[model samples]
Target: MSVLAHLGVEITSSTDDSMDNRKRPAASPNSGSFVFWSSSFRRQPARVLIVEALPPWWSDTCTVLCDALDNFLSLACNLDGPSRIPLLSLYAVSRQQECVLPFVQVRGNLARLHSCVEELRSIPGEGCIKGAARGGELLRQAVLDSLQQFKQYIRHISTGNQTNNNLSVEITVVTSQPGPGIVRQLEMGLKDADLVSLKRLLVVQINSVGDWGQDTPSPETTYTEAEESLMLGTEVELLRMENSVFALETMLKAWLQEQGGDREHLHLLLPSPTDSPNPVCVKCDMQERLISPALIPLTPNLGVKTESVRDFLPVTKASANQNQPPQRLKVIKLLRADGLCESVLYGLPLVIRPTTCWQLDWEEMETNNNLFHALCHTLRGRDLFLLLQVEPAGGSGVYSHYVLQSSTSLSLLLKPVVSRELLLPCSMPVSPQDPVPDAMQTVQCCLTQLDEEFVFNPLSLTNNLYQHLKSRGLISQPRYPYRLQPAAVLRDQSQPPEGAKTTGSRQPRQVKPHSFLQQCEGHEVT
Candidate 1:
């Protein structure tokens, strides 16, 4: 049975089965998707119940949802590992039908702590839905394990040699594809306020050229960096990060190669400073000076307290989407997971915002005209970053059981909502393998990004229930992207005009005005 059916929904098995998962109509174009209950009322700390009667497929969505939490989706092993983590994790839970997402409740060890909001928000104005759902089973499993393992890796703070009772972990996810801020928060969670022991590990699997091209896997060892380094590193990467997967992958490979390319994804693990490694590097004054500026130090006599430790918070992780082929899926998923909101590790719904960026395949565009033409022509020639939201239509024939759930009205959790900055942009980097840049620098060399759209759940007013719920709205009325993208500083050249400079910096520096023809004061002065 499905989670929805358990909650009083009625969907047929054959109709909602895997065989019918496909045939569903294309989702909206100018839409972005985020997860929230489609039911009414945004009551505080409500428990999300997946009942026994819930349909079998309902959990599928949750399964997918959990995998995407915190952008820690399934990623390939080192481009050359022993077969990419097999791409998945599947488990049968006892009462997952009642799997709970308590928004307003965090008691016991977490009573005094402030409520943290974990949102899977959108990037500026766009989203990456439908296709992402197509990641299917293999990718799903990998994503699950990675997330669980990550949860286990998030602990940075020592509970002061206290008992396990004193240890508890809590995290919140924000969206907008955060670069460094999210890392900072995790480091903060695991370190001292002064960020003396920023033990949060940061591993990056940069996007790579086609076929991953013999790149080494990141190390499997755990890592931790101090606040100063974490913050600086965050700023540098976030500001200088390219939307390009290849670039990211390459940089990571280079760093990992130094530590021996034996681990996966060329992982860069920063261990707690207090722990002893080889003392040779620390004794080198020049080396110390070089690294000291980039890294902060941990307190003396430090030890890894197992109890208070949080799960592994990946500085970055990747997962391949099944529907779009492994390669494309890998790139887009990371793009979706770049923000603070997209950083969940375990079964937590860190940031449930809409998908802001999308990676689309050309042929797929033909199925949906609104999105097709929208991509063909900007909104009034306005190339703003737009988000497309989509809900997959499931069931038999054209209309399937999945369709009903996707089309169903929005829940209170989705309404009465407040969100900002969940903007959109193509994740393709302007340049591949470029060095870091300043805070405001952008690699605008490449302007074309995938033009895609998704579903838009239409909001409806209850017969007479709307008045009382005026402040909040129902997340209903599903619509697809007629067009996606809002105007932005980044130019979209996918549909550039004839003779237009197809590829180059959009904002060329103003060259000083020079004389059209400097008179040569040579021997024959003209």
Candidate 2:
């Protein structure tokens, strides 16, 4: 049974004749087959972790790195919004390499992750006496191990599931040793077929203080050198970072940046008229929008904590209306007047731009963009809104958007049609309101004049809950710059005050005073 059913909520999607179906149907010029785009764009490549297990000599660094990894895993598992939780595979490398965890959805797998962390921590140095001497050899072997394990995992999944045959993988390698030997091994091991599935290879070198010499190249140069050596026509990012919590956060931020976590999309394809046979498919990316803040619940029990299945479910690309194939937006109805209210408006609003992905030639793209601007101008001039049936990528849902044009770009305000009536007539006759008083009208005019145009970006804001957790020693600093302060800034504080009282503080019990009012002055009623 699904998690939703376990929670005593039964979700049912129905196909009903709504306003869009009942309205005058528009004629389509194209009678031929509709070419559906591949759903792969909606999904992201799986992330695989290959972290080197440090020996006893690097105990301090090992402790800090393990803690950081744990925090990162927890955060990934409990990410906010309706997006799918990332799938991750964990591998640990020392003198020998071992797969601590296989490909598993990060959501609702905290217990498994904890067990994996334990295994990572317990990994002992192979031949303790020779461990320090064989560090370089271990690093080289680890590189080969990571590549081999990744290939094996990919092959296993491809054989098991045909749909996942084309799935790509993003490999993140965390090692203390970064040298020419490791680079050469990776270059030799990776084949052309392997490169196709490998989206990115992020090498995070955990270095000690004073590891870099005067002749050592910068991180960018290292990345360039690695890419050049691989010669697989693929980019490789190398980050040489110190063994600290701050460095881990930076590594995660860089990794997330590559994963496009910062760049979220609301609707993929723009609304095009059905009359056009070859309608231009304009891909849109969301801007200046904030989702609701979510805090993962901390439970003492071993079982993984879950708030809602919607938060953890894998985000798919199938159309919400399963009967219909993916298309460039469907127009439901055209609004002639401003009759809709806040009651009809549902879900987070999105401001979209056609600057991200496109499936048109340069000449055609320019023409389509010009047409978009014209449409926006027309909508603004006529004070009209287009009610469109938008099936967002990731199978989010079939949402009705009350779309209007801003001076900049198209603004999609999610306003699903309400099935039930909202407004009810009063028993008394309706009375027209008189003209506003002069003083009130003057105040309103002044207020309007004082108003300044301000754009609010949700991505720009930080999560207060996350900050609180960090302050209380419950969580670590977030990976993103917008989410928290930089590592240097965080380190500059030296020591934070202890036992600070914020929200969720325990309050002393209030003592009730003697009820003199109930006693009625001198006369006490029994």
TM-score of 2: 0.40
Clashes of each: 130, 0
TM-score of each: 0.16, 0.40
Q: State, as a TM-score between 0 and 1, how close model 1 is to the true structure.
A: 0.16
Output the number of the lDDT-best candidate.
Answer: 2
Residues 345-368 of candidate 2 have per-residue lDDT tens digits of 333244444443455789887877
Cα lDDT for residue 461, candidate 2: 60
- Runs of candidate 2 with Cα error greater than 4 angstroms are 1-42, 54-57, 80-85, 124-162, 179-181, 188-193, 209-230, 253-292, 295-526
lDDT of each: 0.23, 0.48
